[model samples]
Structures are given as structure tokens and as C-alpha cells.
Target: MLDLLLAAEEGAHAEPTAFFLEPYQWVSVAMVVLIAVFIWKKVPGMITGGLDSKIAAIRAQLDEAKALRAEAEALRNEYQAKIAGAEQDAQAMMDNARREADAILVKAEADSSAMVERRKKMAEDKIAAAEREAIADVRATAVMAATKASRKLIAEKHDAGADKALADEVIAGL
Candidate 1:
């Protein structure tokens, strides 16, 4: 086995001896020079710095997005509070309106009742006045009828003999 390995190593060295004279060897040397030039110019470092700057920009964008989201959430909360306050104010206004309506209704009812009472009182006063006028007219008619009847009776019953006797009696008394 040791002799076989030695024979393989000798064959490898022999192949390389002719490789130096081949076109492939020139290509290999050119590749090595190119690699050395790239290292001297620090191309790998520039690529790494560019990639790091991109990562930093992406991180800054993410931070800005988070800040904007927080501000939007705060604004939403403030609007919700304002909406709640507006609802409360509206409810209070409705309550005040209801109370005012009730008060107005009560006042209107009282005014209507007072007006009805006044109308009733005026009607009663008119009726009393009419009754008093009727009574006065009846009394005046009775007095006039009695006066006429008495004058008729005196005219029929009185005579000149009675009148002379009444005059002589009145003279004796005097």
C-alpha cells in the first residue's frame, strides 16, 4: 500500500511538470493576479460597508413606522373621548328640553283653566243682571195695574151725597 501511494504521488508531480507549459497555467496566473488586485483595492470592505448602510436605513424606517403608529393610536383615543363627551352633552341637552317642555305644558294648562273660570264668572254675572231687570219690570207693571184699578173703583163708588157727609164730618171734627 505504501508503494502504491508513492507511485501515485510520483505520477501527480509528473503531470504538474507539463502543466506549467500549458495555456491553462497562464489562465491560473491571471486569476491569482486579479485576486491580489481586488484585495489591494479593498473591494470586499466596500461591499460590506454598503450592505451595513442599507441595513441601518431599513432599521430607521422601521423605527419611524412604529412612531407613526403610536401617534395614530393616540389620536384615535382622543377622538373616542371627544365622541363620548359629545354624546353626554347631547343627552344633557335632551334632558333640559324635556324639562322645559313639561314646564310649558303645565303653564299652558293653568292658563286655560284660569280663562275658563273667568268666562264662567262673566256668564253668571250676566244671568244675575238679567234676573234683576225682570223682577223690576214685574213690580212696576203690578204697581201701575193697582193704581188704575183703584182709580176705577173710586170713580164708580164715590157720590156727591157721600162726599157732602164726609165734608160735614170733617168740619165737626175740626
Candidate 2:
């Protein structure tokens, strides 16, 4: 066992073998070959190109979103303007209605006043006609009474002697 231990120690201190025949040297060579293959294939440039294309697509999407937002804002403003115009039109219509109502009211008032005046004039004319008729009736009654009184007086005072005198005078004149 002592001799076996001495032989193992001697092997451990021995000089290195040929570079290609060592296991660690073979692993180093494989890594170098793989790195060289990757460089030759331009893998880094392809990766950068792919990343740049993705960035451009994202930027284009962002720009489209901004344009859509601007279009929406413009539409909102247009709708607001239309609403304002509609409100103004409604107010104008209301004003016109009020003016028309006032005009109608004035016309109705005038018509009513005219009707009242016409009725008053008609009443006055009727009253005047009635007064004239009453006056004429009173004058006729007064004339009848005076004629009757004068006839009664003449009948009571006239005598046969005066009648004879009146008769003689009338005959002489004739």
C-alpha cells in the first residue's frame, strides 16, 4: 500500500501530455469552435435587426394611437358645436313663439274694444229714438186736450141773440 501511494504521487507530479490528447484541452477547443461558428453566421447582427424591427412596429402603433386620439377629439368638438347650434335654434324658436303670442294678444284686445264701442253706439242710438217718440206723443196729447177745452168753452158761452147777429152780418157781407 505504501508503494502504491508513492507511485500515485509520482504520477500526479509528472509533466503534461500533448495538448489535443488532454480532456480539459479538448473542452477548450470545442468552446472555441462554437464561438467561431456563431461569429461566422453573423448571429449578433441578425438579433439586433430583429430587435430593431420590433421597436419600429411598436413606434408605428404608438403613432397610430395618437392619430386616432386626435380624430376622436375633433369629432367631440364638432358634436359640441352642433349641440350649441341646436340650443340657439331652440331659443330663437321660443322667442318667435313669444312674439307671435304677443301680437295675437294685441289683436284680440283691439277686436274686443271695437266690439264694445259698436255696442255702446247702438245703445245710444236706440235711446235717442225712444226719446224722440216720447216727445212726439206728448205734443199730440197736448194738442188734443187744448182743442177739447176750447170746444167746451165755445158751446157754453154762445147764445141765440149772438148767433142771430152773426147770421145777419154774414148775410150782409154775402
Candidate 3:
């Protein structure tokens, strides 16, 4: 120690020292002591454990988000199916309405045609009846005329004596 002091006195350019150690060497010794103390306290294990816990929490959150996304997608697919079914039902209803309308039109046409046929039949029957009535009237008028002409001819051709002879012949036959 005395020698080191003498050396320091002899040169102003001597390296500075304290307690037989240089300043740089003391700094190195302090760093080694700090590292040893950290190991003894298990600070490295605590830091790694904290990091591991944080990683596990993040993984759990990711899994939950994935589940939620899958559920949302399923709901979307279900809604899409429902919409498609609704569209199909609407189309079916429209088709049914069109078919019913067509049926109604056909029925109406058939009914109208039947009505026209009935009317035609009734008109023909009326015309036939009128013709028969006119023929009957003409025959009656001809019979009346023929009877008058026959009476005139009989009066002109036969006298009172011929009528008395005809009457006497009818009485004898009876």
C-alpha cells in the first residue's frame, strides 16, 4: 500500500485507484455482484413466468374471437337460407295465382259458349213453331173456301126434286 502511494506521488499521470482496485475494475466487480444477486432472488424466473402468463392470456383471447367469428358466420348462413326459402314461397304463390286465373278464364269461356248454344237452340225452336202455326192457318182458310164452293155447286146442279129423292133413299136404307 505504501509503495502504491509512493508511485502515485512520483507521477501525476498514475492511474487512479481505490482500496487496491482501479475504477474500471470496481465497476466490473459491481456488475458481477448484481448479476449474482438477481439469480439468487429468482428474478429471471419471475420475468419468464410473467411473459408466459401474458402469452397464455393472448392465446385464450384469440380462441374466443375465433369462436365468435364462427358463430356469426353460421348465423349469416341461416339467414341466407331463410331468405331463399321465402323467395321460393313467394314464387310458388305467384304461380298458383296465375294458374287459378287461367282456370277461371277457361270456365267463363265455356259458360259463355254454352249460353250462346242454348240461345241458338231456343231461336230455332221458336221459328219452327211459327212455321207450323202459319201452315195450320192456311189449311183452315183453304178448307173454309172449299166448303163454300162445294155448297154453291151442289145448289146449282141439283133441284128440289133431287134433294127429296136423296132423302127418300137415305130413309129406306135406315
> Per-candidate TM vs. native?
0.40, 0.38, 0.45
lDDT of the candidates, in the order given: 0.91, 0.91, 0.96
Residue 159 displacement in candidate 2 (angstroms): 99
RMSD of 2: 34.2
Stretches > 4 Å off in candidate 2: 1-27, 89-174
Error of 2 at 8 (Å): 5.3
**lDDT string, candidate 1, 82-162, tens digits:** 999999999999999999999999999989999999999999999999999999999999999999999999889999988
After superposition on all CA atoms, what RMSD does each candidate show versus the true structure? 33.4, 34.2, 34.5
lDDT, candidate 1, at 58? 100
Encode model 2's per-residue lDDT on 1-174: one tens digit a residue: 465567687875433456426678878889999989989999989999999999999999999999999999999999999999999999999999999999999999989989999999999999999999999999999999999999999889888988999999999999
Superposed by TM-score, candidate 2 places the C-alpha of residue 169 at a distance from the truth, in angstroms, of 99
* Cα misplacement distance, residue 78 of candidate 3 (Å): 1.0
TM-score of the candidate numbered 3? Answer: 0.45
Error of 2 at 106 (Å): 20
